[model samples]
Target: MLTRAEDGLENLWDSRRAAGMSEPEKLLCRSNLLGSDKRITNYGGGNTSAKVMETDPLTGAQVEVLWVKGSGGDVGSIRMDGFATLYMDKLRALKGVYRGPEHEDEMVGYLPHCTFNLNPRAASIDTPLHAYVPHRHVDHMHPDAIIAIAASRDSRALTAEIFGDEIGWLPWKRPGYELGLWLEQFCRDNPEAKGVVLESHGLFTWADDAGDCYALTLDVINRAMAWFGQKTHGTEAFGGPVRTSLEPRARAAVAARLMPAIRGFVSGGQHMVGHFTDAPEVLEFVNARDMARLAALGTSCPDHFLRTKIRPLVVDFDPAAPDVDAVLGGLKASVEAYRDDYAAYYGRCRRAVSPPMRDPNAVVYLVPGVGMITFARDKATARISGEFYVNAINVMRGADAVSEYRGLPEQEAFDIEYWLLEEAKLQRMPKPKSLAGRVALVTGGAGGIGAATAERLLREGACVVLADIDGDAVAEVGKGLAAGHSADVVRTVTMDVTDEDAVAAAFDRAAVAFGGIDILVSNAGIASSAPVEETTLAMWNRNMDILSTGYFIASREAFRLLQRQGMGGAVVFVGSKNALAASPNAAAYCTAKASELHLARCLALEGAEKGIRVNVVNPDAVLRGSRIWSGEWLDQRASTYGTDKEGLEEMYRNRSMLKRSVFPEDIAEAIYFLASDLSAKSTGNIINVDAGNKDAFTR
Candidate 1:
């Protein structure tokens, strides 16, 4: 057993754990262990494989099969189905039909024919690299320490010096069938080698036994880390910090201000979700004197640049004297210049067969004092892209510390970026949902209609911020929704809509959490049942305070963010049928609801110039799952109808012209229609979900 290196990787292989496992299970265990540490491999950045003897379905005979991590799978979270299975003989047979390098992409087309047992999971491009290696198990990982050496100026010489003939080195080659053949040739040429390093790529280690492969992979990475640590000890990173970092709160404030503006500039094609990280390493690099020079060199690993783009746009912001206004003033020009530069790069690097230039916007943005901001079509992708960039930063730190760092050549990077295979994979992806890039803030989100609306929007791919006065209840609702959808798209805030400061802060949080809000479901409310003569001053004010004043406060905040984002948005108010038809003994509720409806119209008129749409969905007697109906409102309404609480829903149903009961889901459907682009041309419109109430009819 190897002892753990100080601040280096640990040998996580366990003999006991592997004692009773099958070869495939052992491969899985090895992969999870290697992938658990970002120091070992980033999310979805590496592949692992094993050759196992399996029963042939057709002939009931034993056969060799290759089981490798499937396309678009993360090793740490992968399951059995995540591995693509292929017949070893059939994979070997591919070489006979393989053409030269120019026709390499067509080889991927033949991979499906090599499928073992009709496994539907698609094989990754790295499939051949593992298939051609004459070993029972193989591991390919992009560990920062290993990539540091791989990306160094003297990477080939450094590999020989460190491993001393035990590991070999190969020059940069884009991953495909041709590279796989090169690796096979390397293994045969250096029979005693434990593994080989692919320059500007990653590490690949293999052994006949799964445990040995796992141990060897860890050992190689740990040795690289130890070497880098010794060489770089007490050295200045990125030529030392030129700017100090802002305090955490101040950093957040700066990010909150910059993200919406940056998001606006980049989100021309589709709305982008933003992620912010002020990790120590990110701050170190962004604040350094060599930051721009190093960042402009771009990332070394294909996995890094594929997500982060060729390079990040470093924003001009000073930490000592933060002129955020100056930065904001020049942001448009800076962004446009970056886009122009990218187009020029594409123009210079394009081959006759290269795909057309994609979105010209930058994916990663670096602000010296604030942090790193990454934007993508959705929140999870934005977050992952930031993580990959952090890996690139670590690689740069180590490589620059020892030997000069080198990114991939522009032509090579461009080929990989616009590779036809990658384009095909992207084309295979399912269409995005209707609200795929939208962010929504739902008030009273713990209540029935509010939760339903949130759920509806979430299903259509909107990231939702659930804001409510009941913190615990809202948290529970958010948690439940996060379980169904991912936690990345669901956030909860404790908010009292009547509190102006609280409302503003919630909007800021939403901006920080999801770039900015694209939809505001103004549904926070309170219902009071009292006769005009019996209504106390406090009761009337309470109704007006939450219903009328609260709507104004939330809408005002949403409008501010939407205007800042420069993206038109949707605002759907959850009004009451009482707004149109007077209900006996509920004068305060009726009046406040009426005020809410008119406020929607007024805001719609004001917001139309900016492309912001304001609409309302009026619901009547939606008792199921309603928080309002769980309290005094239910008893009061039952009393007014001279019936028990059990009969209230039925009475309301009978009262409607259609004799159909309205539920929170029914109202949610109306709200969704108003909030999505289906109602893009609609503003100042009222959608009544009151089961054909003649009094509430708009026409």
Candidate 2:
């Protein structure tokens, strides 16, 4: 449901293996981006940057430069170490620039340092845009589900209804200097705004802290995508030319017919246009299709005048009409008329006056059965615009195969064409959920952590299964749950995470008992601390058997079943803050817990292809009474705190910035957020429910 930039940017931001970043702090900063939303990006679709003071390599003096995520890194996995150094002045100077769309030779020549010299990485197309961000870090991504819905015909209206004042929708533009300039001014005007949702494009969010950038960007996209998903008609097939090419002669021919339609659509029965593009995806698609039909969708965005001219030469070529020159003559005439109408429309409606009003902003070419053609200044803009018109055409196609395709009544399209209404409807919102039919499976379901989570999920009305190694405990809780109000209700199953057979059997039981599991909580864990020198193999095995191996068992089983059904589900591991921060005499316990975090992170990606979400819940110092916190351990813990039972319990309540230690219930709520309908797009994030306990540095 979410469309991401090609997986080229996967692993850009993340907590672990930020192996190539130049600093340690960025690693800590980047990890905070993962969450239960699809707003910023789904899986890995965007990139980020930090402007740090560094000595210029050539100048040998202290100067400012950007350390941005390398092109291929995943933002979710990105760390300060993954950043590539580039001169800031060089990047900001890219504005007012122009070049060949494909090579972008002039722009590329302007910044030689953007290339990393090793590992064959190119700066992201949004490099100029990132340079424009005033913050220390900048993030950008195509949140699939969100942008996909935002690009549709009714996007402005729908987004208006959902988010009244938090969004800023910019018309699509090629990703580069111009867009950066536009955004820089936008961010300045609305300094407090969370993000800018580029129409027919993606999202942009930034902050001084990498975590803030990651979290805000992700949260916004999730909310937008969720809003769109409900109203969108997700048909299995929405056809468009899988291809298009601008052979010189072919281009001229398509322009003839498309020009008239476009003019009529733009004006009051008004104008037409020609188009061009150099994006790899658009070029790839264009070169593969019949020129005529490919021209119809035109280019990425309607305003992409550079690659795609504003109305093309449209000639309906067929064997029956053999006069080629006459066709060409017809095409030129149509392009002329289209151009004239555009001038009149611009004169009447556009707020500012500019010369060359006759210059068409897009181009289209048509061939009989082959469909239509459109073009733009570059491939990116062309693709965005093409998709918009294509959706409109598809909607109008009706049962007649021969679509009398038209733009939303010409008047409406014209008003929206330059509507400043984007701002009137933009509004930031605290997150909201609309899930009703979703389901979930929480491991450690019968116990404290899992029980707390199950209760929260149940309140959300999800049909759930209480799974645990303690069969009696699971049964006891399962029976106590009220089933009358919930859908398909609750199922209790005994599962041993370390037992592959039992894990498989348990999932199957969940499937039969409640239809199919939708969310999974791998909360079942055994925590025991011991110094590395004194730790016994038996203790190590115990931790591994239950924490690490048991976790894999649950996740692996869930993935297999979830994949079989072709729908998606979410999984959350109850990881401890001890995994990220250091603690003395807890090596074995730490190692097991740390492994669970990585397990979820890696699986977050692996499960992405199947729509199953995977993330971790890292809670700090929860003093819940579990097996490890037995009477003796509790007494020992209480003694260390210099307090009685109540005082010992109160210590964590004021541990961090929030003056609170993580409660089993608090972690459970966070898990519910990740596993439910609200977090449909989130995966691979290590959610810190530690109330700021592991603030990395002593800041």
Instruction: Give the TM-scores of the predictions, in the order they appear.
Output: 0.98, 0.38
Q: Across residues 475-584, which tens digit of lDDT does each residue of candidate 1 receive?
A: 99999999999999999999999999999989888888889989999999888797789999999999999999999999999999999899899999999999999999
Per-residue error for 283 in candidate 1, Å, reads 0.9
Worst 10 residues of 1 by lDDT: 1-10
How many clashing pairs per prediction, in order?
A: 0, 116
Instruction: Report the lDDT of model 2 for residue 387.
Output: 42
**Local error of candidate 2 at residue 338 (angstroms):** 49
The C-alpha stretches of model 2 lying farther than 4 A from their native spots are 1-433, 483-488, 625-628, 631-647, 695-699
